[model samples]
Target: MTRSAPQFLCDPVLETVQVEHGFGTRGAVAPGGTLRPNQVHGNAVARFEGGSGVDPLEADALLSRIPTQSVAVVTADCVPVLVASADGGCVAAVHAGWRGLACGVIPAAIAALSEWGFTDLRAAIGPHARACCYEVDTPVLEALEGPFGPALAEAVRPTRPGHAGLDLQRLALEALSRGGIRSDHRGSAAAMCTVCHPELFDSFRRQGDQAGRMIHWVRPIRDA
Candidate 1:
């Protein structure tokens, strides 16, 4: 197996604490075997205790209090969300495609963390296909609109006759807000569109199945 340097984008808020969180680029590799769930575009979240190796849980989100265990989600066009407790006791990674978002993945993750006794969480939204390049049809808009309402519908601006550009980051932020994460508690979106910045990130919508996946992970730094 070929390993690459740990070239990743870090959120300033997450970096301030003992939490080690990042959004990896195409070739960057994580230190240990990253715990990635088999994302099925649904709103399932898997929780982990201190352990090693991969379990390949069938879910869209992974939550853990184990500092030594890193949880991650791989994405090409979907949004990758990494969240940590205010004190770095717990962390979570979510894979939110439009369908997963529609099914309540963000809120589900928040609830899982809350159940783990975490509060005042901080989150980072990683790179993905932004509204600038994520054009979608009526069903996608409808899936979001019924649950998220008008604000979400407004984010989906009409690009062509029947297609519209959907801002996944905006929708994710809304979901976070609805989950009780204040504006200050969340980091800004990476703001780089994977579809637009092919040299930096990958985009399934742009490159189809040939597009490589990027890993976005977060873990608490274990005490020595």
Candidate 2:
């Protein structure tokens, strides 16, 4: 893939609401006042009210009710999920890996955000290691089966012994579906495979711990 300016991908649903958001690429900078969690690959969420809370929250997701106070999550190969209400009064950023997914990060975050109200929720899954390059073993498969059930087979194709190519994006969409977001309402503006495009993304699967992470963020629109 050709390199572009440090930028972010926008979801049409979020655009309609005019929320300042982005699924970032390498070297990309998000909007101001963005707060990110430490991301332990668990389902926990750190929520902020009108004021900025402590930095480096020990959670996999960040939720913001303050209009200008944005929330973000960083990832190398793991999925970056950005969610918000239609008017952008509430927003969340999630770091979803196979572990987080199996542990229910998506639904957990949505359930947390729902406390504000579940009306017109929208979500977008960002770039990560795609199925074309993301392969998993039996234990990983078994862990995912709880959340994916019979549908898990659809996103998997046998690879090496005890391994299969897994579509992280498909599973992510399924998780969002469980959270009440329709297929059309869920966004994939930057669902490209991070492993496939080293020119544009930083992939841990491809570059290991040395690989850098990309930032994804969302901010509620301040009421006029």
Candidate 3:
């Protein structure tokens, strides 16, 4: 990693690797940046050239060419993924919940940027529900296990006896690795599961039907 400037938002959950020394507030235009939010629950990725329109995308991942600008992904329990390839000068934000993880959204984002000559991209998995509290039905576990083998099965440990809890960020990390991103290029925020740490995070699982989502995004930028 080259150790560039910071382009993280004020919300604290969001993290970035390439664009540096900047921040943004929700609904406010990013200073010298552009923003996009993920629709999530789906495996779609949208690309933006210049800082153009508002609410321009309905996808799980967003990519931008504008340096210092950013695209945002909001989530409560889902994995908020920030990605960048400074060599290619491309950045993306992804919201990969369990469904999105099973649907292969991470690889889709990698493939989307492959057209732009982007390689050796770095990825960051933000705070979300870990295996500690992400209880799930058997179908979801079976779905994950069918592709990833026993490691995923082992990671999704049984909380009680019948139900299993999942490490979603691990799932996303596995997917990223399977997608060809090396471990050296991957970054993860330690601990702080949203469901377990309510004071520090906003979790749908913890907050129930009315939880307010936290947003994460990043973009390429030219120095001002």
Query: Which candidate leads the pack in lDDT?
Result: 2
How high is the lDDT of residue 46 in model 3?
Answer: 86
- Stretches off by above 4 angstroms in model 1 are 1-6, 51-56
Ranking by lDDT: 2, 1, 3
TM-score for each of the candidates:
0.93, 0.94, 0.81
Which of the numbered candidates is closest to the native, going by highest TM-score?
Answer: 2
Worst 10 residues of 1 by lDDT: 48-57
Q: After superposition, how far is residue 156 of candidate 2 from its true place, in Å?
A: 0.8
Ranking, TM-score, top scorer first: 2, 1, 3
Model 2 TM-score? 0.94
CA-RMSD of model 1 = 2.8
* Poorest stretch of ten by lDDT in candidate 3: 20-29
What are the RMSD figures for all models against the true structure?
2.8, 2.3, 6.2
lDDT of 1 by residue, 78-130 (tens): 99999998888789999999998899999999998999888688898999998
The lDDT, on a scale of 0 to 1, for candidate 1 is 0.85
Spell out the clash pairs found in candidate 1. none
> How well is each residue in 1-224 modelled by candidate 2, as lDDT tens digits?
99557878888878877888888889999776678988888998788886548334799988887886888999998998988887778888999999999999998889888876755788998999999999999999999998889889999999889899999888889999988898888989778899999988999999988899899999988992
